[model samples]
Target chain A: MSGYHIAIVGATGAVGSKMMEMLEEATFPIESVTLLASKRSAGKVKNFKGMELVIEETTPDSFEGIDIALFSAGGGISKQFAPEAVKRGAVVIDNTSAYRMDLNVPLVVPEVNEEALRTHQGIIANPNCSTIQMMVALEPIRKKYGLKRIIVSTYQAVSGAGISAIKEMEDQAQHMLNKEGYEANILPCSGDQKHFPIAFNALPQIDVFSDAGYTYEEWKMMNETKKIMADETIKVAATCVRIPVVSGHSESIYFEVEDELATVFGIQQELMIAPGVVLQDDPDTQTYPTPLTAVGKKETFVGRIRKDLDEDKGFHMWVVSDNLLKGAAWNSIQIAESLHKLDLVKI
Target chain B: MSGYHIAIVGATGAVGSKMMEMLEEATFPIESVTLLASKRSAGKVKNFKGMELVIEETTPDSFEGIDIALFSAGGGISKQFAPEAVKRGAVVIDNTSAYRMDLNVPLVVPEVNEEALRTHQGIIANPNCSTIQMMVALEPIRKKYGLKRIIVSTYQAVSGAGISAIKEMEDQAQHMLNKEGYEANILPCSGDQKHFPIAFNALPQIDVFSDAGYTYEEWKMMNETKKIMADETIKVAATCVRIPVVSGHSESIYFEVEDELATVFGIQQELMIAPGVVLQDDPDTQTYPTPLTAVGKKETFVGRIRKDLDEDKGFHMWVVSDNLLKGAAWNSIQIAESLHKLDLVKI
Candidate 1:
């Protein structure tokens, strides 16, 4: 088989830069790599496989010979350029919410629903960062014990917003520690009207508010899970919160199995060997995953598993993973690799 | 009515100091105030109501002539001294977990169950910090619509541990922002063998592990909610986590009410007039309570109330309050005020 051509849109952003690192780490066969970004970053030089590649402005002509194009740019960019890339015969894997809930586009998490890539109509959408890690953790349990309901509360990091939000949080923390005042201009949501400081604090709002008082982030979690799992009957509820962590996102999840006989031990047994999952639960040794411990990792970390004292089928667990890696960049690369393995895209 | 004599045990601790502040703010009639701590702090001076008081070593005889005693010491100190105060004819308001689950003692959050204070057997126990805010937020809805289940995930502050933990978190944050090394000596649980950093991170373990792999703090939230609400049939599950915030504790609570007709507006109406609850739910303006906004306040701030997208009776909300104020000292003072109003304590 001959090597294929790859193009990365938004090459200078947080998740886009991580995609470059993840692609190199995956060692996928590639003939050439094209780095594309906004006009301001067009001439920036980036290294791939020991060769310097100059980033070019992402015009409609940038997808001429590309087999796979990864999009981590803003949703507006994806909305404008994703179809253009597809019209030029490139399979676009978008990491934005622009195409996720489309009726024709398949929202894919490679570990959970790689086969959904087969039905994709030229644009495969990456699930929300919060939803991607959760799908990875819950799919194994759902397969073994027939899932019913999920209630999740997220402890997400500042980096999920962008690179500027991390700088804002650090600057605010320095001012807070020194007993001075700092401005909050980049967080909760950068595009929203109001901004709140994320230093040594927790904000319950993630994205903008959607219908029924749920944020867009929370709505995405609820809707995307049902679509990706291909089970419209599975119930999901989420409260998305941003904490002061820099990289990892943690979730406290409560789930009820359809089978009443499922125990904590049985669920743990299934996750122990599940793909792309790391089980770190041990009560005796005080072992569990924290945001500090899970940063920069590719696998989702699950721990603190316990059965509900009242409901026989209910259980609780903590899931953590690096948001930029497993939640965004690495997942997108995995989808690209899946398309390669399935021969869905021409090389 | 003549003023009564009062004594504060562990007067040098975190909650104890807040108790002093709350007492002054409440303008409760007091003839005399006595401060008591361990032998190491015996010579310290604390001012209450413009009157200087000397800290004495807490002995069994310290309760003599005291009409009420407030205990904020460790569980061991409460266990050894609470009984002595009760035997000496002083009604004790304990902020420790020593007597909270005892069948003889009544665990109280005044907003939810001030009537429970009338049956106190000379000792009224203050509920856990994370549990108190949740009860205040949910008990209003529970009174109108019967509550069936509760699943809570807490984003608690370091001040819940003690003043020293707050210092450790600050030092660690300074080191972390400077890209240097720091130590984790007093977090997650100081009594537990292991310690993890809380700066820019999230720790899933709050207190030590208990039966069935639940932490003692999580267990407290589960058991205390049942005892205070006096409903053993209601199911409860909690995931207690510690974040780097200095004072307030935040919780993402999911609850199921028995009435299928209950709407988000119905629950908001209950909280609007509920005692010690502030409603901040406004999605258009992006209004909600955060840890920094709730610090040093006596009321429990609730917002982001939404009904479950799938279940007819399920709902989700965010609850926040000062862990030292409403969660501990303010709640303790409210219980004392309840005792005075009910004529349960002698002057």
Candidate 2:
């Protein structure tokens, strides 16, 4: 696995930058790291291990000698370039919706569906940001309790929308303080027909509404939950919301298990032993996971666990994680690590 | 009903100031107005109707000549002063939680349960802010479709905590921007042992946690829904979160109806025609109700209407309203109007 060549598509984007940072932190043995982005971002130099690597223009030939290609570009770019990379014998890990939900490609969350990586035809799809953190937090619970139903409402950060949305929030907040009007152009979806300012606001629509009346974000949660848990029988409902927070994604989850009644303390203890999960529940001391505190941290923090008043079999919890780390970059790298450990990716 | 003498208890508080502003806007005739606060605020003067009203200490004798009294102070203050006002023959619309669940006292939302005002025994209780907005949004649907279950996740503003909490959010944001450390003394719950900064964060605990592990705010929503709707069969669950926003409260509500096969457009139309509800859903134009736009608005904004994917009998909607307006002060005044129209208030 030593001296493997890697190509990072969308090297100038938010998730791409974080992926680079995580790769550096993980100290993956890299013979050469090729940074690739659009022509506009070409020639931009990003430092890795005290060496400056100039970002090159992304094209079909970018993965000529690359052993692994990580794609955080938009869906169109992935759809066009992923096959090119795979044709050049480089396994592609796509961070867009282009390959997700496709019958051939595996949508992998390392802790929950690491085995899925072994069966990937060419590209492995990363689940939605909100879905990634949630799956990691709930997988252990599901394993222990035999899950039945899940209801989740997400308090998502602005960074999930990309760097432009973060700027929009800041500019809008300053404009509001100055008593000036600013246009909303980046969120709740950039490609959507219109935009709404997210500064000090919560937008219910994360992606376009699907045929079933659920937003694409909600549908992703529903579909990805079944896929990752490998249980079509589990009922899942999600309401995805964008909040003013900049980094972490927080969720209020209520679940009903098929097992006997589980105490809040028991669930907390189970979560503590779960991989990639940290239990932060302590009501008497006012300790709970929050976005500001979860920023820059890799672990998904769970807190505020309690039994549902009317249902002895149901329990509720609050989950928070850095959307950039555990939700996107770190999770993607974790998949790459799983691939290495399982001998699923060749160098 | 002409030239009635009115008094406002807790005149220095958040809801109290909004009440004063609403009284100025109401068409009801008033002969004189009195401002009453604790001994610390006794010497302060609040401007109302182009005249400064000196604040007086709230006591039993303070309600001697008052025709109508509005109480926005804490529950303790309401518990001590409301009976005194009633004993002095003054009708009181109390904004505290002291009597909301009492079988003897009527808990009212002017548009939803105004009929409850007819049976008030001198003192009327205002429902919780989050509950008030949700009921205003749901009552229309409940009346038209007959609601069965309500699951709500709230993105509540800091202002609902008080003026100080709002200031704390601003200070915290500024401190964060300037790289300064500041203590959180008001949020999550003021009475709770520890506090966490709410700037760029979401706190799942709105009020103190109860024996059942639900926060007081969530419990209030569950209990108040039953009391206000006068139906004990309606199943309700709530997750109350405090965001960095200043005023409006936004709720993601999933509700089940007794009838079958209702579309999102149908629910939107029903909400459009419902009293005190403004429909803001238009996916094509990305128009939806946000807390920033709901500030200072008297109506509850309903949008993001969609049917639940798995439930044919269920629908989801996003509801937003100014917590200080329809949630508290304006609702209080509306209750006064209802009482006056029903000839329930003795003047």
Candidate 3:
């Protein structure tokens, strides 16, 4: 943990750049930092701390002496390079879907499942942005009340797709205002067959739909919740939607607990003490968590807590968090810290 | 029905302007059109059918010779002026919440409960925008397969609040982009104590929270659904969220039907032929309804239809419609058409 050689894969991408920023802010004890990306992004300069680090082309030989590799590249790149990094004895923390649901790979959110990091062999998978924030807000309640069922509808930001999606939104909005036609090229899903404009709109499909009629994004939340919580009996359903927001992901969650006596006040009390969570549920003060206010912040904000009138054991809450921070880079860095504290990262 | 004199209250507001446009498009054999507003907007001029109409201040005597009066002002104005219109032998279509659940006032969506217009004594109540779009999308399904329950999450547009909310969203987004500090004055709820910026964000509380733990917007959807569908046994719950979108309202609806054997294809077929509904549920083509696409359109768009994995009786769909058109103006004009068709209008 004193002096480690670290490599950040996909260094030119959105999450990759954020990871570099977070590492600088956290000032991790690194002997050397290598920035790696595809051949197209090679030779690009990325500023870290007080030094301008040039991005290098990623290859199998690039992980020769790296102690830790953080992968934020696409799933294909992760699938191709992550195993190579692990083979070179580097602990890989992948931010792609390549290994998230793998039986051997631990999907970690530091606030919710830091203990799971103890079992990671060489690679740890970061959960989806929307799922990570929701688990952070709900884990405290789940620990106290014994969660049984969860139904969530996510209003996710455009940045969850990437920097290109944000630019497309801005450009499309400007074109719309100027009475010009602008083609949508980067959303509902980047890899999907077609794109839809998200400026001043909502798209229900966050990822390509699978055979069972659920988008990959929704399925990711469902399976990732089960894996992170280590509970097979908990029922989870998700409807992932893309809104025009830039950073924070907001979720409307309806949850049912095994304990029927859990009240709204009890849930609020639990969230008040939860680490990395802020309670903003004062009705008289007109206080509630909104994505605009939660942007650029690290904490998961929870509010609008109320008991369901029909279901005795059910409650509803609104959760908001900066998707780029707690959902991606910040969580990845926190996991690295957890690994260090647990003495699981080997040099 | 020939040469009827009509008046529009709140003519300067968002819905009122849309109502005026719809009246012009419908070309409803009007002898004269009177625009009425508050003292501030009284002297303004509005164009209808190539003629300039001076907006008059709304008062008791404003409805003296009016055959029909459309009210889009707030509840206080509706409560004060509706009876005056009715007393002057004019049929009143009130777009506010003052008399929606009055039990005496017939709440109607022309596509769903046009028959209810036959029983209206004087004042007819228009359902909430979210409720109107959902009812239009679900009524055909309800008729084919008796509905039991509904759960909806709304991605509502800022224009649903008014023109000021739209302006606030535009201003806030530009201010945020330019790194300038600006106040939030019209979002979440204009009448509420505090305002939050809606640009690049999602606000969970649409209106003030009521005693039942649901926002006023949610309550309006729940009650209005029951009244329009005329089914007291149907259970409905809603979580209404205001997004940065400007025009159309989108909803994710989960419904349970008495017919458990209905397939997704069956529901799609039903929605395709249903009146005032356009089915856009092709995942292969990546075609779906969005607010930006539904802007100026009059039809309610339904897509993303799928069956619940575990529940045989459950189905999910995404519903989108122009809040100003089908939700307000066109619905009002349709009611007027229904009145004429039923010979209910006394001109």
**Cα displacement (Å) at residue A335, model 2:** 0.6
DockQ of each: 0.90, 0.67, 0.65
Task: List the candidate 2 regions with Cα displacement exceeding 4 Å.
Answer: B261-265
Instruction: For residue A208, give model 2's deviation from the true position in Å.
Output: 2.8
Ranking by DockQ: 1, 2, 3
The top-ranked prediction according to lDDT is 1
What is the C-alpha lDDT profile of model 3 across A198-247, one tens digit per residue?
Answer: 88789989989876677999899989999999998788878889999988
Q: Candidate 1 chain A vs. true chain A: TM-score?
A: 0.99
Candidate 3 positional error at A115, Å: 2.8
Better of 1 and 2 by lDDT: 1
Question: How would you encode candidate 1's per-residue C-alpha lDDT over B1-347 as one tens digit per residue?
Answer: 77878899989999999999998976567788899999999999998878888999999999998989999998999999988998989999999999999998999998888888877789999999998999999999999999999999999999999999999999999999999999999888998999999999999998899999999999999999999999999899999999889999999999999998899999999999999999999999999999999998999999999999888999999999999999999999998888888889987
Steric clash pairs (candidate 2): none
Better of 2 and 3 by DockQ: 2
- Each model's backbone clash number: 0, 0, 0
- Each prediction's TM-score versus the true structure: 0.99, 0.97, 0.96
